[model samples]
Target: MSEKFKITITTTLTLVEQFQSTLSSSQTNAGQRPNPSTNEQNKDLDPLALLSASATALKSHVTKLSLLTLTSPFTASAVATTLSTLNASVLPSLVTAALLVTPDSHTAAFQSEIRVLTNTALKELFFLVREIQAVAEAKASKKSLDQSEKDTVTLAAGRVWDACDVVIDVATKGVVGFVVRRAEEYRDLVRDAVEEIEEWDPDEDGDEFFDELLDDDNEDRPTSGDSDDDDEDSEEAAAALRARKKDTLRVLKPIAQIYPAIITNRLKLVPVPLVPSDVKVLESLMRNLQQIPEHIDEVAGALYEEDLQKYTSQVGKTKDCASRAINLVVLPWAAKQSSGDQETVGDKFTTWSKTWIKVMGEVSKSIDKT
Candidate 1:
């Protein structure tokens, strides 16, 4: 092998190793560091923009790496350059962005998510570098690239490309957009759960109910009338089951529908230039809203098995989530208003939350009676 090729190989390998070490430390410390106070100088540093640029740069490098010929003399140098950029610039910017957002509980989860995507991309990039090194070494040994070797490089490059694209996409969305997108996803989940529960057929899918319950609790529950029960008792049991299902759907369907509306309004009411406390309230509100669909799913399962007790309990939990979410929004908005304008400024959200809570309360009472 040429001396230049040998030096390139050593340099690339060293850089990759260094990068791996740095990335490991960054991932370990992600979201744990205290946020630095922002000054006028720091105000110009847009972490999201920096993240997007870094991911884009990495993607460009990976694309070039993917196109490298097995016998290419520049393979090692090219890989080394990418690693240098990653270690020196990309990784530091990512760390800075994460630290800046970590102190705000509202954006903390988002910062962590962005870190995960960036880390995955970095991991894949590291793998691609290794694959490139293997190919370069194989070529130096006068070996022709086999189909498997080619496929390995191609697959690794593709994964790196995909992972970087994900990071870029998320960084482009910024924190608020990320939260809105997530809320929309959760909204869709609620809608899907509502439709699934509305169309559930216990008679047609009797085995499914038993299977799900068995998987969940490792115990069998009654699916229908006991063999010892008389016709009259079975009839009464069927009637009660129908009543329970009706009551559940009546309250839950509207509750599910109203959740998305609440999410939208809350997003609107979120203060611009949010303070730390505001961030906490928004985080709590979103967290509570996210739990609604899970509780709804549980209620659906309970209704499927005609488990009145479980169904009632799940319904209560769902209502509690909705109630808490509403309060999270209303209470914060009210606190922000002045004494003179409190009634006028907060009237809209107050009315909205009160209507929601009142409906939930009424439905909860009716469900209890049933």
Candidate 2:
């Protein structure tokens, strides 16, 4: 285990060094750009984007390494060492990337995106750390090997649940921030449109018909503020505009929720069972996952009604947790592996582990999107 850990660390450090080299090159390239304000700066390859990419590469490598051990029979110490290595060697780059992206202005959406990405990455890091810490505490008291292993696996699973909870919390808050900012932008956009329409002067543009109509109206109309029919027409136009605004809000609200909806649904893919303990952990995750859409609605209700309640109810299914897990993934996988009911447990376990890695890939992609 120690030899393997050393090899893994060496390989990871090599990757980190490569990343550092690339980042240095990118910074130099970015500095050479003549214009910093326009899309040309993007052509120069932004350092923050390169940093984000490097963080992603590092995350992928770590996840792959972790999953390799997690799928197999791994000791608590092994997982701990792996996580600690990641925390020490890889996280600095990720933190640097996040800090570099931190802005004095144009920050809300970008900041939320960075926060969710980094927070998601940290969730996995701290989760393994917690499990390792628990295991160490248990071992210091000299617990039985079997008991300690079981406790470690259980604690690890619980830590995964905690990580999922963190993802949910961060995602919910990110979505809320996104929604609030978008709502403000939409409000301002609508206000500006209305103001522009109201401020239009008939004589500003060469509109012959409008100018002729204005001249005729000015000559024929009475000086009394507005006639009863004109007042009624104006009221109807105002009512129509108000109705359109309400309709626009209704449409925009649901549209705004689509990103969060995709994110929440993608989170369902995160907790795949590595061990039996993980099955329970995933079940716990499902219960909370069931509430995510409702939570989103509750938070965004002030902005506009999005009617995500139905979607919330439809998460996974109304069936029992074990049944759902079995039905959705385990059974299907088992049947696929079966050759006249002679399936190897090892192969089935590997398949299950791979499923977890695949889910983590999905979560990683979602994080990138955020």
Candidate 3:
């Protein structure tokens, strides 16, 4: 158990380092500042200096930050200093400050301009931020943020900022598709058509009723109350009732045809017998994969701990968690070892796993650890 824990930790450290290196190089190539450099600056100075920069010309469009809130990406001094550096590097002294946090700041003329102000002002702010040497002053913080920290920050920022805008289910016969196009829903949709058809059905029913009403073999007729009400007009109502029944049948006919298909192709889970504890752990690992392509450590920890609900929503986005560990990676690899033209069940599982694993990296890596 202890060895497993050690192995897991060591593997995670290595992976985080690998990711950090990739990102570091990418940012360098793109001519963007690496986060670690700013971390070092943050350690030496303060956070506020960086976040609450003096926006002179941009001030008319920039919101002011209180000293309390104007902390650096890493510290207070860094925030203030970075802000000051930015004001000097970009924008004239007269732009004006709104004295708040955000892309929220803007000139009075654009106060009502919600969409334009937020987007346009941010673009302008970044332009000014680019020229500043706010990060240059802090030697200590420049080295400390490291690869993992950068990945974590970047991932979380993306999660909060770029989350899915809409949830729609168009996947073939999946939960989403079935709910939207089920038989019952079709039945309700055609009630108006049924009403129109009801008028015609009563006439059809009247012909049959006439045969019963004028039976030549019997002299007695079964007559009760309201014979006038039961006259030709009543026959129309009878016809209507018959028509209604036909209409209802017609409306439901499509569902009858589709019902068989629903039965034949409904999704089924092949149960794998495992100890409760194992299932719990597996589910936990799956949750983490759902968080992949974004936040790392926090989501990873959640998966490791077997917190299933944490990634329930994210899990639905992809098929990754379904085949996270043995199902996709280990099993598929093993299947390749077998010599045969056709794949075994193991190979089938591996094939399925591969299909969706790209969507669940964080989860798979955790599964590999387990």
Candidate 4:
């Protein structure tokens, strides 16, 4: 009896020491930054570097806790507490500020740095959320936890998740809003360039047409039946129109290519795991935006000048495709069981694409005439 009692005492003490170590580590981790760097010089230039490093370290802590808690049910409380503290901390604010700034505002080197850091932060936060949910579920079924303890764990987990939702929302909106604004600015630039090119040589060099193409002596043909001179004047006008069309296409082609390239670059900057509805909307918008560059290339082709009318029909068909994307993909996704109550799908997606298509049609028409 004495020997058996000694073994039981040793096992209980061992388990107690393990739980103490786990709890102590959780408390220590709560205050710790993700990671630290020895190179002070690099940190000086890139302020976000430390914050991102800290996020990585915190993510490692939570990941370990999540795995450990599977066998040690008592550790769930520690993981929940650490995540709750992180959810209420300075790290999320730092990430939000970093993503809100436009990438163009920084130098190329810094832009790449910030992009990597921001992506890392986003991935870390997503991991944190997932781990917190796991803790909540684990706590709910944990045989070691009393009913009251389980309820507390559930409530704390719920609050941490709520905080995560808020952070994700703000980050997604800030990043995507910046991209949309940049695309709109590029669209305006294209519109203005098209208008300037159109206003130029409005009559297609009508004065030069009279001098070079028409008979110089026949400035004013007789009102009487002089069919020969009238036919000659008509021929000069047609030749001048074609000449003007070619010149316009040469200048506008480069300007038109600018819009889609800039928009695509901006869109690519948006972070992942966006709300499903936003993902659908942005994906559709990107597809439509990319079509601009393709259609412009088609119009810029060697054959386009020979049959401008055919390309105009191509532009119309492109417009139909954009419309179909909205109807078949975007609208249905918006109305999906998962879409919730965001009823302004038309304003959010459909209307924007329609406006874009309208601008493209006007541009195509301008080119068609050339």
Candidate 5:
């Protein structure tokens, strides 16, 4: 709960006579104001009057925002700026806003996004809502947010989470462009494929539908708009497949990069505190990675005939990363408990070299079959 907007008339009206103005608070932004020095005070108005009158108006606006959320559309287009400014250290109450049943594509994408939200970011979001409610209530009550207000603050936490859910749903359909740009800038190394697909176009006919699927600099090279009418259907299908294949890969690649780190806990894979959904998301990423073999074969075949060396080298790198991940995971114990001279970096590398050769035999087979 927050304070009510109340003013004590300690000074006589004669001193600030014009200050007894009407109070009409609404959710609208407090737009630009006339300068205090230049805006002529009404000659009859007391100087003390301006301060209390403005406080009352500010209260009304706060109340309107809370009451009107579900009914009145937020006509204030830029409230997003306010939401964006919310500080990040407050821990949110973990009450479910709604039990939503969504598509897996959306589910998986949202889960990944949620999984990556740093603990600091999550806490900040929850706290930011509380801060807003506190400020709004303070303006209204002339007192601080109280106990029942504290419980009511739970409502705000729920709303904040609902907003996050919306962001996730929008992103799963490849809505990452708008979502990422607005919310936060992700780490550069993590956005490799996404950066590429944002520049790609998927229609052979040069339709804007494929042209603008992502936000990035467009390549102007011509596509096959000249394909015959008889072959158009097949061409369109192939184009659609190409578009989907690339975008999905872009969506999934960063997820793949973090897997080795999290699973092996190489960077100390600690459990995320939010919910059990974190585990489910990781499981799905693994399930997707298992399917990467399917794509690699087709893609490798496409590349192998043209450049066997390139295909051979890619398979080698994939195998190497997997082997290192497994070896490091099993050997962190050595680093954790480095007994005397046995704990040197050179010794650890030597152990991993042997360990990988012994464990990743299937990796070679997969590359061979390719």
Candidate 6:
């Protein structure tokens, strides 16, 4: 590569790596001193607009870099200019705009999502830059460009385009839409768990039945001349084990039915432009909601193993998660209401909590019966 071209590439790569390092260490806010006037001006700045503009600019740069031809006299200068613009201007602006909106706790998750999307785009850009550098080196060394080398650069550019498009699309969705989309993802997971439970048949494996027949055959052989009382006891124990397995599955079905309802109700209850003061409670509620699918898996596994004790324990934990999530929503909203409104809100959520608890109660009853 020419001296100027090498310098530009090195500087650009250094800047991109430094920025990525800063982001990885959660230090994006490190040097951002509070400027009241700047903050006031930024109120009307529109982060989404900035994001879209930056993504567009980055895409344009990637296009220029990807189109560089070995014979073109201006290829080196074009690469240098594009890299300089991307490293010095577009990326920093995009990251700053993304971080600017993240302080609003209500939209923090969505804003974090924007950061993630932006980071992904940056990564793709970095990869493309590296690919361009490789091409520059090849040209410098008078190496003939192989078809694979050409394809690699094209593919890298395509990825950058795709990544930038995703960032733009997500920015267009804004915060409320993003949150709703995430809730939909959670709902799908819970629904999947419900379907899995519904379709599961304990006897499909036939391990217990086969074992029982083997035991029966062994009993008939009577190598040690076991008493009839011993044989009767063995049969009764096997029957009891089968009965317990059936009861556990029965309890699991109803509990599985409750998860979708909880997720749906949560989506309805979540306030848009969430109150900043309630962010922590809302975060806790979201955490619980996210764990529902995993908890369902745990309880179902315990039930399948016919470990009634473990099943009862896991069910209790799941019930607590549901109850706490409901209270997080209801109590915060109700606390902000007048006495009569509070009572009404409390009643509404109490009814829902009761139904969940009642279904969860079946596990205890099943355990006791077993």
TM-score-best of 2 and 3: 2
Give the clashing residue pairs of candidate 6, or none: none
Model 3: residues with Cα > 4 Å off, grouped in runs: 1-231, 250-260, 263-370
Report lDDT per candidate: 0.69, 0.42, 0.32, 0.45, 0.36, 0.68
Instruction: Report the alpha-carbon TM-score of model 3 versus the true structure.
Output: 0.18
Off by more than 4 A, model 4: 1-174, 200-202, 206-273, 293-306, 321-334, 337-370
- lDDT at residue 240 of model 1 (Cα atoms): 74
129: Cα error in model 4, Å: 37
lDDT of 5 at 26: 10
* Cα lDDT tens digits for candidate 4, 1-370: 1343334333433432443344334334433332334223333333334344444444454445445444444454455455444444534434434432222332222233344444444444444445445445555665554555445444544443444444344334444554465456546654564555455442443467666666667678566567777768867866765565555455454445444543444344444334445454555554554454455445334232446566555545444544543443333332544545445533344445455556655655554564
Task: Name the candidate, 1 or 3, with the larger TM-score value.
Answer: 1
> In model 2, what lDDT does residue 136 have?
45
Task: Give lDDT for model 3.
Answer: 0.32
On residues 259-302, what C-alpha lDDT tens digit does candidate 1 reach at each position?
66665666655664557777777677678778999999999888
Predicted structure 3: clash tally: 55
Candidate 2 deviant stretches above 4 angstroms: 1-84, 104-107, 139-370
Best by lDDT: 1
In candidate 2, clashing pairs total: 0
Summarize candidate 2's per-residue lDDT along 65-177 as a digit string, tens digits. 44534343445445546555555655665655544432222133434455555555455545444444444445546643355565555555554445444433443443234
Full candidate order by TM-score, most accurate first: 1, 6, 4, 2, 5, 3
The prediction achieving the highest TM-score against the true structure is 1
